[model samples]
Target chain A: MTAPRLDRGQRPDGADFPDCKRTFMEFNVLPGARAPYGIRNGAGPRRAVAGMVASTYVSGAESEGAYTLHMLTGAKGSGLPLLSHSEAHVTLYVLDGALELVLDGQRYRMGRGDSALVPAGTAYGFVMTRARTVLMAYATATALDSLLAGAPYDGFIPAEDDATGPADLLKGDFPGTTVLGALPEGTDFAEALTTLPETSVPYVLEAGMGERLLVADQLFTFVAGNRQTGDQYLSVMTQGPQGDMIPPHKHLLHDELFFCLDGAMRLKAGDELIELAPGDFCFVPRGTPHAYQFLRPFTNMIGWLQPGIFEPFFHTLGDPTELTRYPQTPAPFRFDRVIAKLDELDIVPLGRPPEAGA
Target chain B: MTAPRLDRGQRPDGADFPDCKRTFMEFNVLPGARAPYGIRNGAGPRRAVAGMVASTYVSGAESEGAYTLHMLTGAKGSGLPLLSHSEAHVTLYVLDGALELVLDGQRYRMGRGDSALVPAGTAYGFVMTRARTVLMAYATATALDSLLAGAPYDGFIPAEDDATGPADLLKGDFPGTTVLGALPEGTDFAEALTTLPETSVPYVLEAGMGERLLVADQLFTFVAGNRQTGDQYLSVMTQGPQGDMIPPHKHLLHDELFFCLDGAMRLKAGDELIELAPGDFCFVPRGTPHAYQFLRPFTNMIGWLQPGIFEPFFHTLGDPTELTRYPQTPAPFRFDRVIAKLDELDIVPLGRPPEAGA
Candidate 1:
């Protein structure tokens, strides 16, 4: 007699593997496959929080209460009072224009691709230095949710040329959020921002500096790592060639988040496929089957994995190289070598081999 | 300060993983990656054994003394006496022409892609039914190596049109090979070879008749599985789309053997890359970094993994489906799901990602 059929997610004997928990949520798609897991194109629900258009693309609920992602836009001169989150690690990546940030009695100017991390309970605030300055912020758990709890606004920030002027700062009694009286003054902006040692103390990484490593054809630059975040999360900038990669696979213990920085890619979640462009974001919770195919050469993506256990996977698989970027024509790589370490690396092949990629 | 540079094959702190054992020996490559791990093209040293040209492509030294692979060619009507291996499981896959096997007093004919398994100590023998008939045979451990001990012959076999008749059977006092008198008589040829239950009994899977499974864009047909071989090995015929697949990976405990059945694929082993055509074979021993890219659409490859511990990986990752062939356009698959199961499965991704495939 023939052996019984084994279904997907089922054992050979017909018993189902434990069903994966769906803890993360996704935002509504904004044309094509664009969603919070991809470029938002200034889309998503917005709130007027402290005089800025706070567009929350990923809420705490979407990240299993680990973090929330928001795109904050404001006109030049827009500023906020010094404030702190009693229990949140806040990280910001400047996407366009410039901003001045004050932390620990020091003032620093941040521009495109620049990033800053504010530890829990650290008093910090910022002022837009260039018109239409945009920042992508991720605050742990519900801290940003509570701080951004304000009146809903149509997703529109009055341009510098508009006469409507900035919107009023909406107020709410948000837990864990403390708004200090006013912004600190008299701290001159440093000529340049220097990255501090990885620790709970606040620090910033310049536009193109971080812990850099090359593995195969991809260059991974870490903006914030386990040591800096106390094992809460890892933020990395990845640049690689454009093509279908990784194949169908899943993670069981940690959630993964992706924010496109440049170029485009097609992502496969379960049976669903979507295309992501610059500014697009995607969140793949633990247990979700996902794969990606870059659509253009040298696709740049920002990736975050929660709880930071998989950090060793990259270090274990990568070689220390002096090269700072992916090679134009990478030498052939051996997937079988990686297959040999599946148990230690948490990478399972989803029956889909790379040959299936178009 | 930046983190320390992590070297390839080294831990983040610079410690090396346990070096993998090199147990399999490879035959000399012939005009490309065309070694015994791939198509042989009638190359390699040969022995005239039991009236057949036995070309030992993969020796016991090559498989960690686990198994050996040989290509046997003989003229039509050439036969062997009933014999049995005392401690070896023998398997045969007909590649060209036809073979008639007699086991337990039952005779059967096997054509291209047809397969048979003879359990250890089981009595069996075979005769070439078609001229220039070729059969790929594998015997556990050194059993076949001992039985095929004969005078080295210039790798040539007399054709049906040749004036010289078949070479006289070379006599050898081989251990574990008990030639039991002559071929069993009065055993009529069975109308068809029917596969027996998965057990330690002689059985045959007629061409195109085996346990077929579709996972992603590949169709895996199992001729001899773990249950049938007492967990010694698994023999599968795989058909999939042509492209880079599986990525750079490694297996720490199991050795993999590949033989091209049709079409072609490029294999990356360490720093070397080679293309394989039909009849080419590749042996990727444990801990070797390797990946494959199919050069044409719908490449067919025969794969065997020793010890059979990885069988469950396929069952776990594959869905029971009615489709008997790979889909022309397979739906997107998720490699992330597999990545999540890295600890459960033995697959470890080399630093390379799918996007790196050329």
Candidate 2:
């Protein structure tokens, strides 16, 4: 697409905050946007690092949204308070040192190779264990796009400064704007979000009637999972093991696409473990038991059911009804009735592996 | 979209290799997909270094595409025949050695910081000056997608009896199968691309009009450089020292996106002199008077417009037009009504840059 929109010409009526209480900047990550932080070339670490840095690259204000790659770094010991979001789901990527994480009555030492998903209405905190760096992102889950447009958090910040004609964003004086497109000086509010405690109860997921989840790796990666129709999830996963008997399972309602990102991977339909790799793509017919895992770790770019994201379901536990039926940690066998009920919901079993020892 | 149709269904059409004089089992840098090739996880190195050995990660037709990363070491003095790509353009990413580079009738010692783009259709060679590792990448200027799909290449060579299956790919193997979902093993062709020699040359660009490109980093972090409507080569350039004047030079009809990747830079827009860093993004409006140089060995990412893709133009430039206007070698400013002729063929600027910048 063309560059994203960058202008916020006029403030919305009644939504405008008093200029005195505000310290804000209006910048978009789109092309041709102004650099607010006044980053001078050949000056300080900015020059040593070589190139410009974004003002703010983390997504806050929305709790359960999926975050994007945060290509940014800042002063050590930088942190924020425990900010809860209402729409998007939040997943924190610990890039360097460990982090102190606290969710509803839970505590965990989250270091590199560790990730946490803060669901909507969930309380979360992040404390830089030791000069920690992470990528925290999320997208709208319920309120949909309207919520993305109407972000609820609005703290008063200034657009222009007194001593400085316009806030020198390239030089990092941007306040309020957690989304700094120019001098993306991370917001102090982001620092406020680090007050979370540790861990609480463990949450596990189970397959329900028409439920399509296959297997998920804690929060690290989702190996094999199904999605409802109209749901979407973008993940870079490696394919599965060969003929790994993935019992017939289907998305009660959803379409699916698996795009190979790296290495070579195999996709198993009914009896097919079709091979795919970078740039090669695959699709799943809704209500199909499609299972895939590579012989090796082939990066699989998976795009599952759109309009309704399915990543959350992977984190959430299954309903009690299915629990009563399966009543097991890892279901011993693929239940036929349960799968049939799932198929009725438009979630159909794509196919099943050959009988064991065959 | 449901899983793509991937059943071979007894069609068995693959195996007709077009780029036929087949070669395999060597490390390579693929066209457009050039990441460092090291030994696969746990795979031993070909030879020991400091304390580690040098094992080849990319091992296929595409693996051999990666020349620099897959520095194979079998017996002493067992360097493989120089495998250079004639179909696609290539550039070297020198990680740990010096490469003898010859370009345009000149020889240059290209080490870590030095990179030379081997234009398509050019005679390029690499001579190892040190026992070091380098990263070399190639980008096809035009007909790249076709080259990726239709080109004769083997994605991987089974590691001498290694029996893991292929990764699931998006490329539908049966060209005639429209609704057919998954692809056959031939899809591994993408990952098969790797390493090329570093017989570097000056950078070049080419692309069809209206096509936008978001060149992403290894982790898929991408930046924008494509054009939009009412766009000009000058429009994207940053405001120089004295207001945003790039001088009275005529718009050459070709624009460029100049982004500082690392280090320090010196830029001239109109009569102003400006410095640059890695994060600082700049634009060189075509047909305008603008010039820049790395005052302190800065690495920059430049996207050229009008000419479209970079590799094709460099490869096609057997006899490049020179400009007598500029006060330097390979002068940056030129008056080529020829640019206008190229523009008429639909290779024109797209949209205007924002009054602001990304």
Candidate 3:
């Protein structure tokens, strides 16, 4: 079906349509070619944390609700507060040094190349046994944005004092999170384990070529992180046409990772511009502003988001149409509506929309 | 440290050491060149089930513990027995058509591009909704050899009747398997779901370059299937030097799968000879005689085995040195001991050693 011709005056919503179509039409536009939805680079704004640093590769906004991937470095003696994600599963793969995790009065130590999985509803806290770098993946049915509420937007968490405890750093009555005052006394930690029905096993759903959603201007196939998998995390493959870009934005909660499987793209994470090719990986930590632009005809990459609560954002805004053409005009979009959703998902826009700024 | 020189009469064990060292010594052997210890190739044997055909791509012998990968094609109306593995987890990804799994008095239907994970100790059976092709992965702490004991050596299973039940096809008291005569009455099918401890989450271990083991005539890095991961099926990456070959042998149980990542090799599965290159895949089913010879400087591939029971076979018979060089002489091995272990694992030799035959 032909897309409706976008005319600003005809639509009373005052929604803005990307100028890509106009640019293509002005040239010798190829028939059946659709315009790219938007461009997003891996580089965006930067945020500094006290005694720790994190760089995100993919963000909840980009993952369309999968899992978040990030690289976190904890300084010697640094520790995160005791916290629990009531609806998220967190995984940590130590890349260097050692990490000590305190869970329900039990202590576990993980060294370099070691991994640990913390199921949802488990109260846990972690301290760096030494200076450590870790790859963290948080998978959940809820959005990380909500779970990370009250976390510092920038700068290191202030040193703990007599009046303040770890829980003071987190804000909001986030249903997904519970900051433990202290290890519960006489608590049966085993009761927190996830239980499934006897006849039920973990189910996997595969999305074929014909199954895809057009979110933000890219075509995506959900590989994991669905309701069937208990929304542990979201894994997806995305294809973006050349010139597609996403305006600068940052996620308050959630990390994102990208593996370029084919094609090329230019990523902007903070002030750094990274040009990625096939087989390259990029991590974007929470609170790091980032954007990207496809450099070739089309770029394909695998993206994951942590605490996969943000997936519904795409379903709410994206079109479930098969992507066959490029350079086609986008449907009119209300910026206010888009921004409203982003705000709820803890996504902060750092710049004007591409069309508006251009 | 230098390897001890082989003296035919010095060792009391009649196990024959490979002549690879002598052959290298006769030539201009490169100094410090070590030998490869891992064996990885997808081309192996073929097996026929009643109304179904399966070929293994990776075997536990090559995976170093993690998992076995295989491809199975089912006739339109074919079904497997109501069986369960107490120590292995099974995952099935439907590549084509539909499949109906009967588990715990419940029926789950999966279509193309669908997947299901069957936890250990769950009694289940399956029937093809139509002519179907599927990729199956069996992850376990035990080796698949014991679970598949006493099945046919060749040809399809005879149609089931009152006199011959599905349980009769299996021999030996494999602790992992329990074939239900009929769906148990008042069975709490929900109890079969996999449950993890509160502190448990899936763990991943990474094998580095220094962690490889030499077995047979190849170098392998264990990718999965180790005690750290509870000995789930083994996944390993192997590199074989040029001219390296394994004599024809057959496993009575378990399947092997291979994915050629680099170089080339010639594989003999039963009477069929197939050449493989990068990106090629081969599956060797249980009971099919197979052997392979590396054709180029070196061939690299990924191999996996189900149940992982056969991994000990390599440790028991092959050298366990860190691979430092290529085209190094293989330590001498006693075929009688090798055969003894093979017999216990349900492996049968079909031809003489490569050097003796050459």
Candidate 4:
């Protein structure tokens, strides 16, 4: 096979060259392949609302209810309607220009190269002092979509006068958002901030590779959970040694998709058994019993569960071990309590426990 | 702002958290803001074939014409119809079991922890040796959809005899794939391999922060091009000092999207001038003349060009200098030749050169 070095321009009578394969062995080392997320160009459909033009780059329909990514281009002197999301947090990053936000009866000014986290239930509105473009991310899917219902312009809308006023757009109270009137008199910025209701602020975990939770023989990293994303789906990455297996179980309200990042695994979905390797993907729909065992020395997989409310199961069942728990021995847990917790999470166990069974 | 540290559970009388403000001073050090891509769960609709089942996790409609990601599960005694793609390269990663591929008069067996690249225009067929599952990626938009037309079973297909065979499935040559007969006799594996045509193999650059291509005052990393991903788009990451600019130009065949990874940039698209800071995104549709100037020192941005055919323009126009070119001095190029090459790539230069005017 190594004897003949075919010339670059040469073509055989009947043979064809195969395309080269680029293996993502050092997954994180490569800048492009290190991330599995898709990019939605912000150049999609846009809607005009008063002085602001909003466009969605990523909708919840595509994010598995994780978040909705959108852009707001505020024309000079334009602003969004005074609004609040009852259940969703909004994070805004100013890309250009400056914004003066009146939130909770206090005024705050944010300029270019700034970001703000608006906690859920916070009443806030902003006006662009100069023509500004802002990238905004909402923790909930339908909050923004519902708020800007009929304002999307099919094509580009010039920064000219519009008939719709911000107040008129908020005539009907939205489910997650509350429309408020004017600010109260003599409101102090610092005083108002301390008076505001305590809400869970959306936080981005800047976890390094060394930061991970070890549960028994598996090492897990919680990427995004309901607490941060305000969505039901949780994204988790787990690595385990060979022979590590999870008992067959089914979920009631959540579906899961597992992406094999490294090594191999034997997965049993219902009565069907399938094998998975790196770059492989498997979807275990809701109510479909499934279990998997690592078949290689080490197996790394990313799992996403819709309605990520079940993440607490790991916290309750697993120990908070360090990240460097390789060659790990199985940690014992109370089987009865584990089984009961699974039941509470709507997970029906179908097979024997991991250590006791094959 | 620091005076009042309200209790975690305490609520103010009438105020709420306005929002937080975090500037990307150290972009990568920030946990949630480093990666710009979104994750796609591999849990979508599934269809059963004669002796196997298939499902799609990420479709092309979601990835902006980049790639279609999917999976296939083959049962015992099950096989896929012999097929070949005309315009899209198919990369398969074996997740479980084993696959026997019949290609170019040769038989290659691959098991779990293995992968293969099936080039376009090559006739190939595969069968599962045991119960197997494979994850597949197509470099084209609609090739896989066209080949698997009307053969998807809603539920599981038992591992029993079926009427559909390889020939029956390929009554007509599909748009991207062709069905073929068995390999010719007396073909030597080594001889055939040598006789195969020579093609450019896709390569990955494990470039560190220190490695980059310096073209004048700008530093670029050629992330992905036609030789690597086959088609659709080219991804490039570039960084430069403040005042670094690209002259206004428009492409006739490809749209361009810019993702601001760090720092700020002033972008002019058509008649609109928008300033983009970190976490911001902008799209310049094909035929829309645009240019950008970095507004801050050490500004970095990721650029994606649809159809990815013009990536060679950079290679042709710029000299391949060392990666460590910070505080880079400008390199001059022949304007007449550069303009001619731009015209060849369907790029209409509408503004002055980067250093000549602004």
lDDT of 1 by residue, A220-255 (tens): 777788887878888888866554445578878877
TM-score of 2: 0.29
Residue A142 CA displacement from its true place in model 2, Å: 4.3
Cα TM-score per model? 0.44, 0.29, 0.31, 0.32
Q: Per-candidate TM-score, first chain only? A: 0.81, 0.36, 0.43, 0.45
Per-residue CA lDDT of model 4 for B1-358, tens digit only, reads 0111111111112122122111111111111221222211121345555345555543455445444545565554455566667776654544444556665446665443233445566666676654223434434556776555545443222222343434445465566666665323332222112111223232212211212455656666554555645555565667665653466777787766665554456666665555554434555657776778775434567666667787767776666654332322455543455666665665777654544311
Which runs in model 3 stand beyond 4 Å of their true positions? A1-135, A138-257, A260-358, B1-69, B72-256, B259-280, B283-313, B316-358
Instruction: List the DockQ of the predictions in order.
Output: 0.01, 0.02, 0.01, 0.01
* Cα lDDT tens digits for candidate 2, A1-358: 1111111111122122122222222211211221111111111111101111112222222112322122222122233334344544444433333345555445554433234545545545444433213222223343222212221211111111112211222233212122222222222221112212223112211111122232321012342222211123333232221113234445644444454433334454433334443333444434444555443211223332332444444333222121111111232223433433442344434333334321
Which candidate's lDDT is highest?
1
Question: Could you tell me which 10 consecutive residues in candidate 2 chain B have the lowest summed lDDT?
Answer: B215-224
lDDT (Cα, tens digit) per residue for candidate 1, span B157-191:
53213222222222345677777756655545674
Candidate 3 - CAPRI tier?
incorrect
Supply candidate 4's per-residue lDDT for A29.
Answer: 15
Q: Which of 3 and 4 is the better model by lDDT?
A: 4
Q: Give the TM-score of candidate 1.
A: 0.44
Query: Largest TM-score belongs to which candidate?
Result: 1
Of 1 and 4, the candidate ranking higher by TM-score: 1
Please, what are the lDDT tens digits per residue for candidate 2 over residues B24-138?
1111222323221212211312333211123332222322231222222111111111223344444333322343444433445433323345544544443443322232232
How well is each residue in A207-290 modelled by candidate 4, as lDDT tens digits? 112225655557776545556445555666676655534667788776666655545565656554455544345556577777
Lowest summed-lDDT stretch of 10 residues in model 2 chain A? A43-52
